[model samples]
Target: MTEIPAFKKNLPTQIAVLGGGSWATAIIKILSENNVKIKWWLRRKSDVDFIKKYNHNPSYLTDAPLNPRKVRAYHKMHDALNGVEYVILAVPAAFIPDALKNLNRNHFAGKKIVSAIKGMIPEENMLVTDWMEKVFGVPQNMLAAIAGPCHAEEVALEKQSYLTIASPNLQVAQDYANLMSCRYIQANPIGDLYGVEYCAVIKNIIAMACGITHGLGYGDNFQAVMVSNAMQEIKRFLDIVYPDPYRDLHSSGYLGDLLVTAYSQFSRNRTFGNMIGRGYSVKSAQIEMNMVAEGYYAVKSIHQVNKQYDVSMPIIDAVYNILYEKAIPANEIMTLRTFLK
Candidate 1:
């Protein structure tokens, strides 16, 4: 973690953080260590002032300190994007449309955009890439995403982590593969954007199932079985959606994420699932967790897409009912329906 091997090649001139959340703040901390200057956006001037004085964000990741010198806090999103060559979007999946509606004031022609957020879009049932293309009109060449076991809490501790940068555009993905590929954070660049998105979406769903297992006192062996089958379902959908273009979904971004999300203490999705498995209603889980679980978001969206694409994603269905219905828990998601059949 001393010298960034990736920085030896080239550095992005300026970085823009599009959200004021912990993930955005944590990334700003990482990029700042390389001496990269950043313009960060928070919705309120109060946040900008709080970050300036405290250096510690009280809302999320309070233990992590953002370098005041390296980060210029801005009151507006457009102001944050000013003079930035790269935009790191860390907003939640649900907030993207409205977030971008505010961002649409300025036109970004060539700036590289990277989505650090994971989960499916709710109303449109679209992935971030789909939204980016439809709303921002980002050319296929300019968009890239980071997915895998990258967690904001771990990144704050400078944990040695690995993730993949994927896009149809090789050069753009490589650019991020280059920036984020440091000793602590290893980057694997892949060319299949759809595969990466599906992996990101489905992992959240499986993590919820993992939570269910944990809550039920099913233990790790049951988790091992669920995750193994979860990957099988992910691969099946990926085969039909991406066909031959992408490699097996078991690569770190897909299965790797599933394992981490299922087991990690930081996974809100798993925690929420545990609550559900313990007989807490989905509404109660959401209220108690406070933090958004990407799995809860993915359940319905994944089910919708599965039906349309003629691919069966059963884990997603189980989670959807657990969250959205009064289905008896003893009978619902009893086991691997697809595999057992």
Candidate 2:
């Protein structure tokens, strides 16, 4: 375990969780366990009413019991943001723009922002931190990212999980980490904000590649090689893009995150890849899953971003080909196998 810095004094006590998905519910469960007060934002009035009445989310993670006394649910963003010092944004990356379309810089003025979103903004191809900073005038010191090998389903079950909180400000990161730590969850604080955030997005795309190969009938041996190569690929990209010499790719924030997403039963990205491997068209697979597989969008956005870096990412190319260019999955994986170390 990494040594945790001493908790900073006088950190924000009031916090709001902004989203209604499984991740958001998992966060609420952790906060509830700690006996913290949370103002939660769900999209619909009916969902808010249901959670308030039943002490459980109606749609996602219904089994995770919430403490209604500790949590208040609201349908409007502004209503949820009221009087909160830190806002944890758990909304899907693709929908973040539209979700905050009603508000401006003033809405976010005095709040510290933590992003639990592990994706790029689809329209801007920007990390959530960059999007928030550029669009809302939030400074880097005020932003933090939560990265994980941890999944919402496992968190809901009270299973042990680890999370890394990355930010440029060590004090702020440590302060937030203390809030998230509990008996079942371990929180680590680090300063590699850009690298960790980029890895969070990159791992989803690589997980999709793993899923595509799995769906194409490849076994564990091939997967082992692919994951190894994927790690090297991630290192290569982050080195060129973020260039931190001390960043450890093997940490839970990076490699562990890749392994879980690549193989976990709850991985929507892997499931999406499996469908494509089993002969489902991209549209058909997406329709069937009824969830946002971040990799489907990440592949395109990352591919475009990589053009400036010109990194050798055959796996990313293969996924982009299969997902966006209509290349057959079997053929793409066969070609991909030749490039893996």
Candidate 3:
């Protein structure tokens, strides 16, 4: 058991981000707006120089320039964690296993760790919080998940966005909500850790459904239907993982997020789905988007877990066929709709 360090007197409000990517840069902009200090740790010196010179990430978020004066970039993770009260992980879900490989779990030191990255590991099929607990021995009470419809592209533009900060601990949720609250960003504290994570995973599949519908030349009617059905499937799946997730189930966070993600032009998950619908292979869609379409990763993970628990997630199954089984997005839907109907 690692003992948490007592905060030193007069330490500034510092949040350390563990990955250097578009979402990280966007959140830094949002956090800076709240007058909080941010230290972003990256693996590359080029990113450091890019932000230092251009006030933006050239690789990930060139369109949304970061103000170098407002945020500091660090090369070493250790330097970033020093004196930081809260830590946010912003890397891709696939990279998490490797990210945790070198991190000093003790350095977390029982700090409030929030997962801004939303996806499940392929092998373990574990949510970010579950992965953290297994690998780092972090407690659920200290873990927070940021999930909702806000996009990095929109957040960078300083648009009005709402999200939920959730954990089993209400104070933990509130602490993140308070820390993340800003002029352009509104955050609501939520209590269901299961619902928050489930929403984060399921929205991508809904986005996939949207992409296929768009490719098939359908209008809002298809989107409306997809969103409704997707939520029902997510609720069913969550019921299997947590038999009583309905106790705190709120569509505002889950369904609202699904709605925006499925329709938003900036959604990588939806765009990735579009590519699959347009005959691009999954590998190629990944290439075109550059960012991990979390739903793509979750398709396999959720499928494996669903089988383990005998939980039926038709939307996840449709996405799995399109992404992994190389089924056309529209054809995949047709294949599933018959049995589902």
Candidate 4:
């Protein structure tokens, strides 16, 4: 674990948390523990109204408290971001474009931007931080990403969880880390911005792969082998794409995050993959879950991005082939098993 830095206490007094999902509500719950006020932006006016009147999300994490006194819900992006000093984006990666469509670069001028999003921008194959910089003109130094073995469900339970705050600026990472730290959560900082984000994105795909195998009735023995190999695949991809000698793939930021996402019941990617393995069509599984799997989109993005480098990513290939190429999951996994050992 990297030691938490000693910096001037400069926590933002007000923050804008975008998105109306379970993750967004859980973050509002965390921030509600502190003195800082939160301006939460939900896409639907009904959901926003529900939070205001009932002090809890109507769709997700309804059991979690919202505390109307510290948290104010908004339907408009402009109203949510009006006077905030920091912005924490928690929406699904696929909806990010529409979420911020009404705003421009000027909207994020001096605010510290943190991505609670784990998946990359689809089609563009860009990390959220990179996309934010290019589209919103937010500087790299002002940006940070949150990676976790932590799940929103677990956070709502106040279960002990840890998060990695990655940024180009150590102090900036530390600053957000301090804000995110609470009794149930321990936030740490690292400077390997790209490495952390890429691993986070890759892990979802791995989790999907794990789910597919489990749904096929594969035993724990086989699942163990797949996850171990998945870690190696992540290391190779990260080493080639964003080389950092000091980055530890085994740390909580990398391997730990992957493990939880791959195995946890709360992982939507894993749940999505399981449905696929159980013979649900892609569209059907998506409709049943009614939540973004992330891996469903990320597989294609990573596949396209990996075309240039051509890393030996068998697990990723198996997922892409099954999800995109319409390859049989059983056949894909059988072939994938041969390459694992």
The TM-score leader among the candidates is 4
- Model 2, 107-174: lDDT tens digits are 88888899999999996989999999999999999999999999999999899999999999998899
Model 3: lDDT of residue 233: 85
Candidate 3 residue lDDT tens string, 1-341:
97656764434578898888778877887777665678888879888877777777877767886656568888877888888888999988888888768776798876888988778877888888888888888888899999877888888778999988888899989978887888889999988887778778878877987897677666887567767777778877777787663444555577778878888988888898888777788888788787788888887888888887776677778878777777766777777666443
TM-score of each: 0.91, 0.95, 0.92, 0.96
| Tens digit of per-residue lDDT, candidate 1, span 1-341 | 58768756464358888887777877776677664778888876888888888887768888888777777888877778877888888888888778778566255667888888788789798888778878878777788888878788998898988888998889888877877766688887888887888788888888888888678777787788778878888888888877765486667887788788888998888888888889998888889877778778777888888787877667777777777776655567674444533
- Candidate 4 residue 145 Cα shift, in angstroms, is 0.3
C-alpha local distance difference test of each model: 0.79, 0.90, 0.80, 0.92
Residue range 1-341, candidate 4, lDDT tens digits: 97655663545379999999988888888878777889999989999888889999999998998787789999889988988888999999988987888899889999999999988898789999999999999999999999998999999999999999999999999988888899999999999999999999999999999999999999889989999999999989988999999999999999999999999999999999999999999999999999999898899999999998999999999999999999999999999999997
Clashes of 2: 0
Worst 10 residues of 1 by lDDT: 332-341
Candidate 2 residue spans exceeding 4 A from truth = 1-12
In terms of lDDT, the poorest run of 10 residues in model 4 is 3-12
Q: What is candidate 1's CA lDDT for residue 318?
A: 77
Give the higher-TM-score candidate: 2 or 3. 2
TM-score of 3: 0.92
